[model samples]
Target chain A: MTAVSKLLRRSETAVLAILIVVMLVIGVINPAFWQADNLFNLLRANVVIGIMALSVLTVMISGGIDVSFPAFAVAAMYLTVIAMNAAGYQGVVLPFIGATLIGLLCGLANAFFIHTFRMIPLIVTLGSASVVRGLLLGLVGTSIINIDRMPPSLIAFGSSTVDIGGSKLSLMIFIYLGIAVLMWLFLTRTMAGRAVFAYGDDAESAKRVGFNTRRTVYLVYGLAGALAGFAGLLHSSMIWLANPRDFVGYELDVIAAVVLGGASIFGGRGSVFGTILGVFMLTLIKNSLIIMRIDNTWQGVVVGCVIVIATALTAWRDRKALV
Target chain B: MNKLTDFRRFVNRDNNIVQLLVITAIIFLLMSALEPHKFLRYYNFESISFIFPELGIVAIAMMLAMLTGGIDLSVIGIANLAGILAGVFFTRLYPAGPDAGAAAELMRVAAGVVLALGVGLLAGTLNGLLIAKVKITPILATLGTGQIFTGFCMVLTGGPAIVGFPAWWGFIGNGKILGVAVPLILFLVVAVLIAVMLTKTPFGLNLFLIGTNPRAAVFAGLRTERMVLYSYMLSGTLAALAGIVLSGRTNAAKSDYGTSYLLQAVLISVLGGTNPAGGKGTVLGVSIAVIALMLLASGFQMMRFSNHLIDFIWGGFLLLVMVINVLRNRGR
Candidate 1:
């Protein structure tokens, strides 16, 4: 009984409850929402954003925020595609690896400036976001790569699916689940992961306790960048087009997801489970609006209201606890 | 000898203003040297005068928010919403065929301006309440509100530009007063007023104190929450003023117009030496930085550089300024 009550007290449980409630409400509004194909489509649509949210969760856990990952993601995706087309490379693994590496480099640039100058993470990432995006659009090419120009292997990979009870499921969902599980393990059962929590909770104390704060910072941002990069490529593949200007205003959405998942913007709190739930909640609300027959114009207002109300509630709860 | 020393001390007191002046001078000289025929033309400078004020005002608004250890990402959204609403008002009550007397037209435009500013005031109040009373982090609160504002704009206009503003409205953006661009004059007046407010007002001093140390300010018996709320309100009004100028200049208002200005505003604020971490900035410094960037942008355009490259340079400039500030602090 105690264990069950404790579970209910956890923030993840609240997020889960909310998610279920929203799903049920939407399902009732539009019976088509409960269809297996629609469900699978929703899950598939969440793959890229889910992966990026996990990255954001990591950074927030380390007491920092990154608005540059979307820029990094698009840069990696566009540059990787451009490079592959130029070199006549046709494989998927090499492009993914190259994109991830590029993302890691951008992340490190952020980590370097932040660590060396002791600058605020927000400002550093903001600057880097601008630089990466400007370079991608300016130095490289600004045109979108259509299906004819996109590598065949990537499109094939994107289109590949598994039949589950006569329903087609994109193979990308499994990768997202795999990454989420790995992240959960890394954040829960590892010494390095604990170090991240400690640093976020109290940086000065963590340093005094001989934790390698520098390594923690790098690990957090580097992993975020790499995931963002991988997600970017995956997004292009799934969509079957590579647009340089993709993900222009996606940072807020991803950040909103993570925060809604019960992550503290002030740091030292968050979970992979809660974050995934948050992503689903957001994705469902966004995708189901059309099914529910709501005017598409009201989408932004609805999402914005949800974000503000949810964050305000969480903040209020935290304040009450302090008092 | 005494007056000279006093002047030196004044200059040395805030090195950022002097540094901004020097940078502006260098940019001006370099642009002139590179493209004398194009850059030094009368029309080029005139166009810049008309263009920089909207961005300049928004940057100042950003600086005000930063002063209180917060940021108002909703500035651009507020600008657009204000402009769009004003456009809606004008379209609804526009005198057909100039049948109405000139007095009525003037009244309509004046009412439109008030309505636009009122929208800003209300939006800012919401932002302030969210940040102050609700205790949500400033960034997240503003981000959500920005979306709401933009979404409201879309619902109002149904995803198209609202055009057909009054002819007199254009004068605010494009007219000249005593050989000075109207927008330029407005920007200068706003800058001077803000400089005085920051330096002379009790509210301004309280903002710096609160940003520098919230706990201390609270203990010192300051109404930190109210001060923050007021600052955001002022920021919103300034943004609305920018929006008015923007709509007047373009003779239209759209949901996505000046989307890029958000980035430019942040860049200009930081370039002006406003510490993002809060408690430090100067109106004079920000004004000079905006002009310097305007000059650089114009020069780049003259040289046929893509707008993207200019954006890239602005980002690089932000990072470079960060490094310089750090090194200088270390030396001190």
Candidate 2:
């Protein structure tokens, strides 16, 4: 293929170009938007979304959509916090393990249902989303979790950061970046990662090629659940309180970002880089809307329009490629 | 041998109808047993019947879209928007006056219904165009348009409900006609219309063919795109009708009203035996499913069950039904 065609084909390139254009427009509209402090704040605010976007990207690339991530994250985070408060556990590893385990179970349930029934992943995840959210509310009610009494290690993780040119950066940024980098390696360089793409591309063919599609499906969903769990822990730490309503409707945001990042909802097409850009693009749109003094009610309008347009553009591009 | 063969045919015909009937029986018996004092009362039944149609109409609308292997998540959005539009037109065109005559009131009601239905048709047509013409996936397209519609409604009302309807406006929602609730009658009319459309018409036959195999349908000279568009339009209009019932009953028009109904609509449609994958469902199946769910929901509410638990049950019930359907299909 020609270099121009190859470059145009890469989702990351297209996303990066769009990101630049958006940034340029926003910066032109309000130079204050380009301020380092504001930029850092935006990244800090979107750390959870950024992290969750990667998990979604991976799952989507593996040929499934998990709308239950928010539910998994909230449930895991709540369980961890409740456990720590009740048992007085100090170390972070215990809580992380606890959260990840819950995520694993939720993911397993998702995979089990999808595989056994041969049902659409979207429908299965949709049902599971409610079940988990309902369980959260039914079992825990509307209680708010306060982390004021948590161990110092937990506090440090949420609050501590290195001085980067006299700017306050939360430790969560590094965690987010670290996970993205690792995910990049896993998706691009590992056999399992290749298998994920293969399975997503065509499950029947992947099975014929000796790839264990079902196991891959389980692992992908389980890993997504685990990452969501970790992200939830970080989220609760950053916010210092876990309300039951927290993260309830944020799955749509995550899905939108991932889709914007150039991941086809049809699966077998997405990247970690694209997801990061997608998250950044969405976060930037949100921040820009605030900067431009747009009413909060219009935020949905802007985001929804962007999602639809982005998907439409992607669909058009796919059709063109086929032609 | 003839009697045994006849019994086998009865058992084997339409598993879903049988399953729905058996489920209805079980829930009825259970509710009767548990709430022996209240369940069988005419008042309780009336209350259940009163609240049934707003959701039932929307579910039937969703069933049409599902029959074409697509879903209309925009139902709630369109419903709310339609109500809001009707509200806007009604209040603006015929402001409430102290000495307004019956003629003015009749005009206001007629205007509201026409405006609401027109808005529903327009919104649904947009959805159909986007999905069929633009080739966007139903989930994302509806998701986006749902936002847009809701956003427009928000801009119209500025986040609060629009109130102040004529005194007679609530008749359709709360009044009874010949010993039957007006909304129930409306629901029945809608259900019958959809039933006839799906089973007794060539359009419905082609819809099933298109859903089952798009390429085959295309080869057979069916206008698949138009079929999908019409299906969505029909779904949208029905949802809007539901919105009218909702607004009338509550005496307000709000963008966020019945947010829960989005999922409940999908649940009801699925429970009614509408296939999510398309090409297989019936209006009768959906109506029966809605009744079953409403019964369960009311029973649970009467027992003072938490709303969260009810949500849990709804979600779990959806999953359970799908699983059973899978097993039954496999057995066949």
Candidate 3:
């Protein structure tokens, strides 16, 4: 009973309970929401954003917020496609690797500015986001790569599916899940991960305790960039197009998801499981609004309300605990 | 020797303003030298005067919010919603007929302006309440509220531009008084009021103290919450003023209008020497920074550079400023 009560008290449990309630409500309103194909589609939709949320989770856990990952992702995906077309390289691995490295370099730029200058991560990332996006659109090219120009191997890889109960699920969904599991392990089982949490809780104490704060910052941001790059490429593949303007407004959505998952905006408090649940909850709401026959225009308002209420509740709870 | 030292102290104290003035001068000289005829035109300056005020106002609003160690990401949303609501008001009630009297038209436009400013105040108050009362982080709260405001805009407009504002309303955006643009005059008045308020008033001092150290401010018996709420409300009103200027200038409002201004506002505020962490900024520095960037932008326009390239340059300029500020701080 005590164990069950403790489980019930966990933040992730609250998110899970709320998510289930939301899903049931949506399902009751629209039976089509329960369709296997629609559910699979929701899972597939989760792949890109889910991966991005994991990246954000890492950054949030390390006492930093990155609004630049979307820009990095789009830039990597666009540039990789351009390079593939230029070199006539069709292999999946090389392109993915290239995109990840590009993202890492961009992430390193953020780390360098933030760590060296001790600048606020938000402003540094904002500056870098603009620079990367402007460079991508201005110098590289603003044109879209159509399906005809997209590498056949990449498209094929994107289309590959796994059979589950005779319903086809995109292979990318599995990859997303795999990445999430790996992230959970790394965050829980690794010393470096503990250092990230330590730094987030109190940077000065973490430093006094002999953690390599610089390396942790780099690792956290670098991994985030690499994941964002991978997700960007995956997004393009799934959509079967490479547009420089893709993910123009995804930063907020990803951040909102991470925060919704019970992560403190101030850092040092969140879980991988909660983040996954948060992403799913958000994805479900966004994907099912049409099915629920709600006006599409209300989407932003609904999401905004959810964010405010959730954060306010958490704030109130924290204040209560202090009292 | 004493006079020289006094002058030096003055220069050091207002270092950001001095640097911005030098940058502004350099930009002005470069633009004039590069395209003497096009860049130095009387019409060019006039057009910029009309346009820069809206942006300048929004930047100042951003500065105020940053002064509290907070940010208002919803400024653009508030601006657009204010304009759209006013536009909706004008379209709904103000009749377009020969029978309509000038007084009635003026009254209607006045009501519409109030409604717009009211929307700004309400939206800003909501942001303030969320941050101060609910105790949510400022950035996240503003981000959420910005979306809500934008969503309301979408609901009202349903994806098309709202047009048909009264003819008299255009004066707010484009009219001239004493050979000076009305918007420019409004901007000047606002700049002076805010500068005085920031430097000369207890509210302003309290804000700076709160931003510098919230715990200390509280310990000193300051009502930090109320001050933050008022600052956000003021910021919201300023944003609405920008919205009025914008819709007036264009004679239309839309959900996505001035989307690019959001980034530019943040950039200009920081470039103007407002510390993002809060507690320090000035109207003069922000004003000069806006002018410098505007000059640079107009010069690039003269050179026939693409808008994308201009955006790239702006981003590069922000990074350069960041690096310079860091180096300067370290030197100090």
Candidate 4:
């Protein structure tokens, strides 16, 4: 009984329960939601968001928020796509490498500003997001380039599906799941990962404990930027277009997903399982809303309300625990 | 020793104001050299006057929230909603008919203003309640509310701008009073009133105290929660006023109108030397900073720079200023 209570007490348990209920409800309303084909498609659709949520989880776990992820991702992906088309670089590896490198450079810049000035991450990321977006707009001129013109191998990889008895699954699902498992391992097994949690819990104490706080900050933010870049590649593959404005306003949704996954915004509290669940929950909400025939315009309302309510409930539960 | 003290005081007091003046001068000179004919004209300055006040008022609203150690990202949302609600009132109450008299026009405009401002207050109160009562982090709370407010604005207007306001409504936006733009006049009045309240009122002092040291304020018997509510409520009302003027000037109300103003307002507030962590800012400083930015923006536009380039410059400038600030503090 005590073990059951302990499991139930975990915040992620509540989120998992909520997600299951939502999925069941949606399945009941639209029987097609449970179809194997639709389920696989849903998993493919959520890969990019799932990847980005992991990146956000890393930063949030290390006591920071990076709203600049979308901007960095868009900038890196756009540049790579533009360059690949210009140079006629056909292979998938080169584009991924280029995007990750650009993302790393941008991440280093973010780290430089945060380390040197010690400004609030929120404000710094906000500024950096604008700068990157503005640079893209100024240089690229808001043009949407079609990735369909790219190498056939990359497009095939993006669109390729495998048959399993009767259900087809896109290659992107395995990629996202692979990344999530790696992140989970890193967070649980590595000393550097432990340092990230300590830094988030108490920066000064982490420093006192002889952790290289600066390097941790750099690694955390750089990893996030790199993952975002990878996600950008996947996103372009999924959409078959590299538009500068494609992913600009979805930071809030991504942040909402991470927070819903039981990561405290205050820091030092989150898990890979929780983050994946959070991503799934948001994707479920979005898919269910569409199945319900709700207007696309009202989507923000639902997401915003969910974020506020979830955070409020967490705060209440924490307070109750204190008493 | 006395002379050194006086010099230090001057350095501390005139720092941001001096920065503002120098940036403004550089922009003015650049514009003069680039667009000698058009930039020097009286009409150009008048047009700038109309444009700057809407941005300036919103910046001031942001400044007030920052002074309370919180940010109100919902200012733009509130501004848009206020304008939308007022637009609704104008279209519904007046109906844009020929039989409407001067008296009806007056009533229509009056009702519109009141309703818009009232909605602004309600939005602010909601923010206050969430932040103070629910104990949610201010940034997250406001971010969520801002999204919801923007969604509401979109749902209300059905994604199209509401237009056809009364003819007299133009007076608030475009009219000249003794050769001064009405919006500029209103901006100054609001600035003065806010300046006085910030400097002279007990409420204002309590706000600063709460921001700088909430525990100290609470231990000193301050009603910290109520003061926080009051601060956000004031911010909301100011955003609403800006919205009214903005919608009136544009002669339309839309959810996405002035979407860019969000970043601009935060840029202006910070450029004006308002501390993001709160407890330090000045109306005069913010007003001067607004002008400096407006001049820069006008000069950039005249040079045929794209709006995107201007945004890049603003973002770069924000980072540069903080770098300088941090360096200066370290040196001290």
lDDT on C-alpha atoms for all candidate structures: 0.91, 0.85, 0.91, 0.85
Q: Model 1 scores what on Cα lDDT?
A: 0.91
The C-alpha TM-scores of every prediction are 0.98, 0.95, 0.97, 0.95
User: Superposing all C-alpha atoms, what RMSD in Å does each candidate have to the true structure?
Assistant: 1.5, 2.2, 1.6, 2.3
Model 2 misses residue A51 by how many Å? 1.8
lDDT of 4 by residue, A1-323 (tens): 69999999888899999988988888888888888887887787789999999999999998888888899899988888888788887778878888888888887788888877898787788888889988899878688887656555557668878898678888888889899999999998999999989998888999999999999989988998899888887788677778888786678889888988998777788999999999888887876687767877787678778888877876676554321
Error of 2 at B124 (Å): 1.1
| Cα lDDT of model 4 by residue, B1-332, tens digit | 99999988987887877777777788789888999988888878889999999999999999988987889888989999999988887787557557877898888888888898999999999888888778776777888888888888887888999897777677888888999999999999999999999989998888888878877888999998899988889999999999989988999989988877888888889888888888888898899889988888888888898989888988888888778777877887
Q: What is the C-alpha lDDT profile of model 1 across A256-277, one tens digit per residue?
A: 8998999988788999999998
Give per-residue CA lDDT, model 3, range B245-325, as digits (tens).
999999999998987788889889999999999898899989999999999999999998878778878877887887888
Taking the tens digit of each residue's C-alpha lDDT, what string does model 2 give over B1-332?
Answer: 99998877976766678899899889999999999788888998898788989999999988888887888888999999988887887677668677878998888788888888889999899999988888887877888888788878887888999887666778878889999999999999998988898889989998899778877888899998999999999988998999999898888989989987877888888877788888888888888998999889888888988888888888899899889889988987
- State the displacement of the C-alpha of residue A188, model 3, in Å, after optimal TM-score superposition: 1.4
Indicate the DockQ of the complex predicted as candidate 4.
0.60
Docking quality level of the chain pair in candidate 1: medium
What's model 1's lDDT at A273? 94
Per-residue C-alpha lDDT of model 1 across residues B1-332, encoded as one tens digit per residue: 99999989988887888888888999999999999999999999999999999999999999999998899899999999999999988887554355877888788889889999999999999999998888888899999999899989988998999998998788888889999999999999999999899889999899899888887898999998999999999999999999999999999999988988987888889889888778998898899899999999999999999998888888888888888889989998
Instruction: Give the CA lDDT, 0 to 100, for residue B225 in model 1.
Output: 91
Candidate 3 lDDT by residue in tens digits, A1-323: 69999999888999999999999999899989888889999999999999999999999989899999999999999999999999999799999999999999999889998898888888888888888998899899989999999999999999999888878989898899999999999999999999999999889999999999999999999999999999999999999999999998799899999988998877788899999999998899888889999999988888888888888877876674321
Top DockQ hit: 1
